[model samples]
Target: MNKTFKIYAVIFIIIMVILALLEVSKKEVTDWRKNFDVNEKSPFGLFVFNKEIKDLFKNNFTKIDVTPYDYYSEKNKKPHNILVVESEVDQESWNKILDEVSKGSDAMIIATRIPKNISDSIGFYNSKISFEEQNVLKLTDKKYQNDFIELDKFPSGRGFSYIKPNVQVLGKTVEKNNEDQANFIKATFGKGNIYVHCEPLFLTNYYLLKSGNVKYAQSIFSYLGDKETIWFVESNTKESSSLLRFILANPALKYAWWVFLGGIVLFIFFNVKRKQRIVPIIEPLKNTSADFVKSIGNLYLQEGDFHDMMAKKAQYFLNKVRLDLLIDTQNLDEEFSKKLQLKTGKSAELVNEAISLIKKAQDPYAGVMKEDLGRMNKLLDGILK
Candidate 1:
């Protein structure tokens, strides 16, 4: 218990010191627009932040910052409505929001563009551009009645709208063409409410400095005002989990390290400062020179290499016989043939050719062919017989 306490004390001190240093150095989140010096804020702070959005939602909505990192905790919190803030929308994530909203929950999305595939899935009415508008508008056309529910009407020429099943256009862009205008729309999926915003500028830091944006931001939250629970979803999210907390909570994962350490310690204990056990060591006996040659010769004989060796030995014996028989050293072939006929009952031709073959074996590159070796063996056997 005392050792464990010491270990924990050392760990706590180290963590405190590291955290203190981090607190001294403020880092910016590069991808996101830094609003109000994020270095001054907690690393976990900020969800959807822009100067324009901060000013608008700053007063009414409590700053409850949720992120993908805090997904499980926020998921556990079970907010009344979830807001997904993304620069782009993907089908899977969009579908997830829709499914959640279909349960009568509320979800709001703020993005640059929503794909036509998504509109097709939820069944939205497609409208061609008639003209450009500056103020947010309502489509008074009766044909788009089932497709759009106007929250605010554009003042002059400001908004573009599209209609589809279960979806409605709330606001449109006046500065750009109908196809090019930024659109803010809403759709219903299952039991949930989904709000889709076209442009991020209206909620960003730069746009918030403008005059009418505060009202725009207010109107957005007002439409979603009743959602008790809220979430901000980043675009194209796959399921993920928190690593540190997960390992700490799972005992089996933690125990694996202890097991590994224990095995290593046991190995060290067995290896060092351990008593040595005596064992017998037998020395190999070395053979003499004659014994080595005899051993090699016996091996060759057993393995059929002895047949070629025997043929050579027989040829050497014949050479000695040639000297003993007194054949001329230079013309031994014809002279040896006459002497071989006189000494042995074998043919002179066979004896003369056999002597030449054995002499040919003296060539460094020459070797016995399988058939010649077999013939040589037969000749030696016959001569010996």
Candidate 2:
């Protein structure tokens, strides 16, 4: 009972030790998971940070609505007095928007980098201009004044320029550290006016809150008055994921079952070869094999086998005792029994009785009863343990 209690206590302590170690671990957000939920409109994107223009327009403007356009869904909207387009505008979508504006509707497009055709018309590549054109802009608070319209800037031809000859230039390619400063032009198309901004960052939440670009937003809003304003927010949506990008990112396509079969065939032809070798056998020296015998005996004992099982086990142990003590069958008396009992730590009477039973037991092969085997096993284990 005490041995069993110790075994259980050791097992329980091991389990508790493992549990205590496990309690020290903590999990954090991975880069992939963090980047997953980040969208263009997310707080991390330009939408959350730029506040100067948004605040100015939101309070003064009576009717304000926003629509997102991709390659599709850029057509067939009621004409408005003011239009704003940011981000990538598909060729077809912009053409449709231009068509609407041609019908006397006003618009403002802020592109850090204008498209090739539009940029060409505005002489974007001309060396006469003092600045490089790009699509994204970065503006500092010092660069922007109460009159300045801030825009976001990035490298490459991502700055603003004017394609329309009739458009009135607000701020030309100014000699400054800010790459975003470009031809902020206002053009008259038919009966309506169009404002083409080089940078859209002024409208973003970040610039709105930091700089006084809110004044420019208020000016744009005041020009349009209470007229319904349409803000076209472009998104890639369904057409955003390119097939080439998909194929590159997903390598599983290269290792499909058919592909794997083809790879196996190539490998077999180029690399695999059959070879012959000899295997050697090792013979082990004999050692005391009591552990193997005890394991097999324990299995049989746990199965509750009766009759011959107990008699066989008792005979096996009795033979070992006889060999160790050199006891002869004819002279197996009290002195021999006492010597065997002293060697095995068994009671003298029990050892004698167990030996007698092993020698005189009925043949288990001749249908010996299970109850008699049980009684014999009880006696044997009592002496052995």
The clash number for model 1 is 38
- Name the weakest run of 10 consecutive residues (lDDT summed) in model 1: 36-45
Superpose all Cα atoms of candidate 2 onto the true structure and report the RMSD in Å to 1 decimal: 33.2
Relative to the true structure, how large is the alpha-carbon lDDT of every model?
A: 0.52, 0.51
List, residue by residue over 1-385, the lDDT tens digit for candidate 1. Answer: 4585467557655765575567447574534332322222222223235323434444333333444334432454333576655434445656655656676766666543457676555555333333333434222235432332222222123222546545666665543334434366677776666776644444444434445444556666556745454445332232236675577557566555444555576457546867888978988777688898999878775786534574566556666665665554445467657766676678866776666665645444566665666566566556545
lDDT of 2: 0.51
- How badly does each model clash, as a count of residue pairs? 38, 31
Give the per-residue Cα lDDT of candidate 1 at 129: 39
Q: In model 1, what lDDT does residue 344 have?
A: 67
Once fitted onto the true fold, the runs of candidate 1 whose alpha carbons sit more than 4 angstroms away are: 1-79, 87-91, 125-162, 176-182, 233-385
